[model samples]
Target chain A: MTLSSGTVAPGAPTRTATGSVTVRALRLLESFTAERPELSLSELARRSGTPLSTVHRLVGDLMEWGALERDPSTGRIRVGLRLWEVASLAPRALSLREAAIPVLEDVAAVTHENVQLGVREGDEVVFVERIRGRRSVRLLTRVGGRFALPPTGIGLALLAHAPADVQERVCAGPLRRFTPYTVTDPVRLRAMLAEVRRSGVAVSDRQVTDDAVSVAAPVFDRSRAIRAAVSVVVEADTGRPAQLTPLVRAAALSIGRALG
Target chain B: MTLSSGTVAPGAPTRTATGSVTVRALRLLESFTAERPELSLSELARRSGTPLSTVHRLVGDLMEWGALERDPSTGRIRVGLRLWEVASLAPRALSLREAAIPVLEDVAAVTHENVQLGVREGDEVVFVERIRGRRSVRLLTRVGGRFALPPTGIGLALLAHAPADVQERVCAGPLRRFTPYTVTDPVRLRAMLAEVRRSGVAVSDRQVTDDAVSVAAPVFDRSRAIRAAVSVVVEADTGRPAQLTPLVRAAALSIGRALG
Candidate 1:
């Protein structure tokens, strides 16, 4: 998902001509999104709102440190492998994905469905891992992409276990609807979340897309606190969410145990 | 692997007390490793060689930009999910991994061996993806980790196709020996690389570990230039590198075609 440039911390220093160099460099990085994975120097300067000369110097530093790379043939800039190496140490994403992959693989192997893992990031659900089954329906999600808390099963599971304020904030929202089956009513969404919390499983039927359904369950850490969520998504026409509920729950439990 | 702080550009500014703020911030990120994924602010300062006051301010800015995260329970800092999300767009790592995964999975499924993908970064080979089969031999390699260019099969494949300068530099010596079978002699390593180039595959028999053997082949891009390498590692005792060579080569070819 595209990072919002306005997501600055409250009370943080304002972005101005003399703003923090670190922030400006990071904004340059944020400018490279899924849609525009590569950009020229001028594009980077424009997108990051930095002076051309400053962007040039910052880009050089970033390239040297391996935070960004220059394409040899095209001379465009993209995220560097070294940055990915450091970011791989992020416990919230790759570490969690490592812990859940074996179990996710098992679910995908048995059900031949799209298996996913996600964690709450603010009011959004950041998908950390996804295994596309050989026979699974196409999903709109991708690894490292974010979705609203009430849209997909994995998001629902995480939202159900989230703090009250987060739940309320989502419940009282101008929720984006993807399909006719998507639950947009605050009352209905609350009931769905409550059911997820009570049953330890969330069934999202065609909520994200008209052709897909997902069954999800929350994963816990050693402290018995919900840390992430796992789900198995399948084609809506012939999907059996009820039958897959126990499998998804079992995978979630196994992932939680692995995390411990 | 621990990133060497000395890997700065040839003419980059010296990291003095009044050096670039962006460099200091990046060094702070470099302080976190696979082994020490979490660190206190003071530890970060110590590891990054930045003043505590500067580190504190940098850490604040980093945390605000979602480049770093503070664990709520431990109050320790680590790489943030936002950084990982941005890094996931790195074409050399995750994007290549995405293109190679289907073929890698096929190799893993058919051989029930350890599948790995790696790309050259300077003189080192950085592993971007790895899939351990259920019945595969244990491996020392991890995703996002770096290895020397002469020992592992994937490394050899990349090294064989590397630029002349890179190949010669690696062949110059001081190779770390991981096992009795690891090729330490520059002459022998050069011969191995030659064979890899001629045969379109590299075999590492008990190189990194005494009990495992790996067969690797180089993956090419649309321009027919070697971009990465793919390998399947198996138990040394029962492994048939000769039998697996063609399979690894085919997987590599499939991955390269996918990259097109």
Candidate 2:
């Protein structure tokens, strides 16, 4: 699930002249993923593209500051608690997650669907939080994971509110096809985005997967800027996208009010 | 709640050479605390001790990178979700919290007491997560908050497993007193820790507050190193500490199994 070493995370600044090894160190941390949470020192060095000694020194600094810690027996490194405590204060994610959870719980309780919250990050939509219902359909998204902005219902809702260039660039995407129903053609995708803007809700039926259909709506901040999207995924067959729109939109509005 | 201006975060490194104006900029970010989650540029500069112009420039960098964001209505600085995303990968707190929550909940359900999960951080105990029982006595602790690692039952549980030197250092401390029942004498505290180690559980009878007593036990990793402590806080006079030990220890064991 993790990108290979030497693959710098997106938004990583061009590392040319600034005596900013710090940002690069942060980008190095971006290499650790949920699938590969623990990494050996050599693996970290290799993955971060830093010299072993440099990695060792930086790791030492991080450990000292409680940003990183090694498993005493395995000698593998894991993310430390201090980082999490600081992160818990991230207003955009934490506040949104806190507001969205109860509504997502309500959504899941009613539809027994997969409930999700996503926000725009550059050309992608990052799933900030997710809650699965007991008998929900399968989903590929994970909390804190990112996906291209034109594929899913939540993605379309976010894309509909993005700047013209962002939307244009997404429309120009070499869109990855997950199923036969995915709208790979830029023209059709643009129309879908426009319809999302028109109806104030987005329907992504079996676009992400063959057996799932998601209904999503935009969540706005005080300026009515689309800050987030809320969605519920139910079984593809007998899926009532229109019927679920009001429920999804209501959840989005509640979250928007909470955010405001 | 926040210290000096643009203090560097865990991953940030500042240089004395560039007189790295960025260091002061980072301090502006630190100016926002859990209590005061937002700040204006003046507040940022004043708190961080940076020049107003430098604060402006550094704030721009952080705002650009989404490490800090402005409230749409108030234009106040708040911690950004991007920083939260980067820091959420920290596995230490969340992993322990996830493993411990169900067991903590179970303990709280059975005892109607506040159940908490905490790990040792420096000479303090930082609460990773907590489940407040309906009938539990109020505690001074909050999730993601820190306290001295001596008086609380969870603290003793973790401290009991700490190295001899670490325990000695804690005993050497100017221990803060919460109530008359709090053990202030080092000799008595040392004896308490010894008994905790021997019994594999720790009990604090009204150590933190006049009304609350707590029972706690250690959560071990597969390597048998104490990773976290789980505890239940109840009314001091309602239950015997010895009787609560088995229940707290059982919860800790449940968490240990979950971690494994």
Candidate 3:
């Protein structure tokens, strides 16, 4: 997928740190996604667009901090446990996931579907946790994995509740598509966001992947701010989004109470 | 909370560009334990024993990777979400936690106790996860917290299964005490470790805290190697240790199965 260079705002870290070699060293990390969890030093330098010397220094610092660890056999650097331990405590991710787990558990038990918890982080939604039954529909998302906040049900639910500026900024640019059903039109996406707020839940039918449909509802914090969103993803053709909506919404509400 | 000044024998990264400054920066990160999640820049430099310039440069690399995040309101450095995201995937922490969750959930549900999971990391047992029932007893250990593998039940369970060299080294000296009942004698501690292995369980009664008792059992990987342990901490005076043993051991066995 091609990212629109024009759509990348000036304030974005990707833009702000374009010239900093230290920042370039750090971007080497972004190359090690869940699907690609390890890389060689030269591979990192190549992917992050940095010199080998810069990559070496940066990797040393990162490995020292336990941000990156080397596979003993392959000597490839991968994201370290120390990094994950620290990130797991991010109040947005950990606490939200903790408060939502019991609720997510109940939802999973009831529907025997994939239950996901997510919160908005910038233009994306980071999946905080997911509980999948054996028969849960296949999906690409994993805990701590991030996805654009417009195409996912949880994303739509969160986006509908996001600040006006963030919504406008996101809608001002490129939209991504997975399947033919994925929403790509800015005006229509905005309309759907408004409808999500009015309806108290978000529904995406075969948007993320061809075989999955998701129903999600916003979770509120003690201050009545939208804190997170819970979604149930099921096999699209066999799933009844309407039938699953109330269960997902109730789980989100229960989690909201726990968060408060 | 003092660590001996030595190299991380297996995985420490040596910085050719910088000397002790590399390890010093790492020490700064090590300072952010479960008890201390955030620190000012001065605190970082002080704890690291590095010049402010070095600290500043190191912090830049760290912040770039999201291993260290600045608290937006306070402008202090805290363990970042990027770090936590990576650590949450640690096989020792995440996989162990995932494997133990169901069994821990069962124990927490049945006994309404504080269920814990931990694994050996270096000479210490790092708590990976915990499920606190509504009526759980008071406790000190926390998820992501570390303690010497000689006091807590889970720690003792792990220590029991460790190799001879590790056991001899641990029992040689530096047995810190948490309370009056803490076993400071290496000989006595060694005996306890042996008993834990023989009996396939451990009970830490008022070892760390005066009012709590933890019953623990070891969890094994597919190769029948000890990978971690699970425990349930309850009010010291409210339960029989004998009754809790079978339950904790069964839960640990269930977790081992999950791991396999």
Candidate 4:
């Protein structure tokens, strides 16, 4: 989540409002990102655009509740383990991850390729878990990171099953171009989604990066509604998407059954 | 985390204080547990001791900020994926898990035993990650769960290197017994800690359950401060703690080096 100054607008006269205090506290947390996991008090105040005094009070409340922690050696602030424990109860991420890990591990063992699980969030795909293959090509994705829905195998599988509005919003593009192989045209992207639904698999050959290709399949819940997508990524030149299709599809099925 | 009405005590007249709003928001989140991951609005209000009106407003703000989500099918509130994404940046958990996963995977592949990573929190050990062994004994632990720091091997390893005050406080009694083989006596527990320090490995033979035993070793950061613990658990009847000691220790060292 990106930190925004609009969370506590300067011109708003209700700075001390109880509701705004809660919003300010949450925004202070938003200030800590993967890039800057640790921040000093002044840095947090400046980044969050809150007054120093307000930041100090909010940080104290957060620390007392264990939402934030002070680093022992550097004395900088960081996201706390207590918060992670509570957030682990998130069913969309945790339940899906629990059901998919065994299947993903099996695929990773056999292929020695990157295995990933993702779900569509709005017009993007949010990765829930990833198992790095020992000798696989380097990946730009990380757990909890987001990527555009048109450039990844997992994204395509999810977009294929997404609602009409979501699909249209994504296909009505400013589709990002990661590599020359990335399909950016709105018409072609829609065609690919249709192909994904028909074939029950999606292939992104060197779309996200020039060195890697991924094969993905959709996972369904008990109601037969698409719940998640699973994929395996490997070196572009050596990997065969056709050969990987059945394995990926089977893994998705097993995960869905486990979820049920 | 346990939810308590004490958060917004009825006896305390400062219920409308700005600070209390932040506290109330957090306590509402604490109401969510692994067993009851989703709850209705009235359940949340009743559990948190906040009035339904207050819960309605707080839930609105929280949902708007993506700290909470409503299930599409059930209409019950659950922890949001966005919160999990933000909490994923908690350095104590995330950085440690990233460093140890490769080593833990190797150990799991070789032994087909449960491999776990944990860190000390106050007087408890909070599990950060676990890789289940297909053929291993069923464990009572889960990721993000907390347990007392005396009965399990990972807890023992962490307790051995904990500060003097923490060690004294724990050894001062009330060590809850999990099984007949659990070491609850303060004298015996102290002796076990000393042995863990001397040998650089801890063995808990059926301390947590009648069917399992584990061997754990402490992982240290660059400053030589104990940062976490890694362990392998297997069936007690056929598992050999002595045979697993070196493998667990080496994995710990490799993880520590990776952290550096």
TM-score of each: 0.93, 0.79, 0.78, 0.93
Give, for candidate 2 chain A, the lowest lDDT window spanning 10 residues.
A1-10
Q: Which pairs of residues collide in candidate 4?
A: none
**Cα TM-score of candidate 1:** 0.93
Which ranges in model 1 have alpha carbons more than 4 Å from their true place?
A: A1-18, B1-19
| Number of the top-ranking candidate, with DockQ as the measure | 1
Model 1 lDDT per residue over B1-260, tens place: 21224433334443345545676678688899888999987898889887886677778768867999887778788899999999998988767888999998898899888899999999888999988898889888789988887899999999999989989999997899999999999999999989989999999999999999989999998898899999999888888778998788899999999997
Residue-pair clashes, model 3: 15
With candidate 2 superimposed using the best TM-score fit, by how many Å does residue A27's alpha carbon deviate from the native?
A: 2.1
> Which candidate model has the greater TM-score, 2 or 3?
2
Candidate 3 chain B weakest lDDT stretch, 10 residues: B1-10
lDDT of candidates 1 onward, in order: 0.86, 0.76, 0.76, 0.87
lDDT of 4 by residue, A51-98 (tens): 886677677667767889988888899999998999999999888898
In lDDT terms, which candidate is top?
Answer: 4
lDDT by residue for model 2 (A1-260), tens: 11122333333342335323444444556668877878887898998788886576556545544556776677688776666676677666767777777688678768877899999878888888776676778788877778877779999999998999999888998999999999999999999988999999999989999988889999997788878999998888876767898899999999888875
Interface DockQ of each model:
0.47, 0.25, 0.26, 0.42
- Flag clash pairs in model 2: B5-B27, B5-B48, B6-B26, B6-B27, B6-B28, B7-B27
Which digits, one per residue and each the tens of the lDDT, describe model 4 over residues B1-260?
22123432343332345545666677789889888999998999998888886677667657767788888888899998878888999999888898999899889989989999999999999999998887688888899989898999999999999999999999997888999999989999999999999999999999999999989999998899999999999999888778999999999999999998
Clashing pairs for model 1 are: none
Error of 2 at B243 (Å): 8.0
Q: What's the CA error at residue A94 for candidate 2, in Å?
A: 2.5
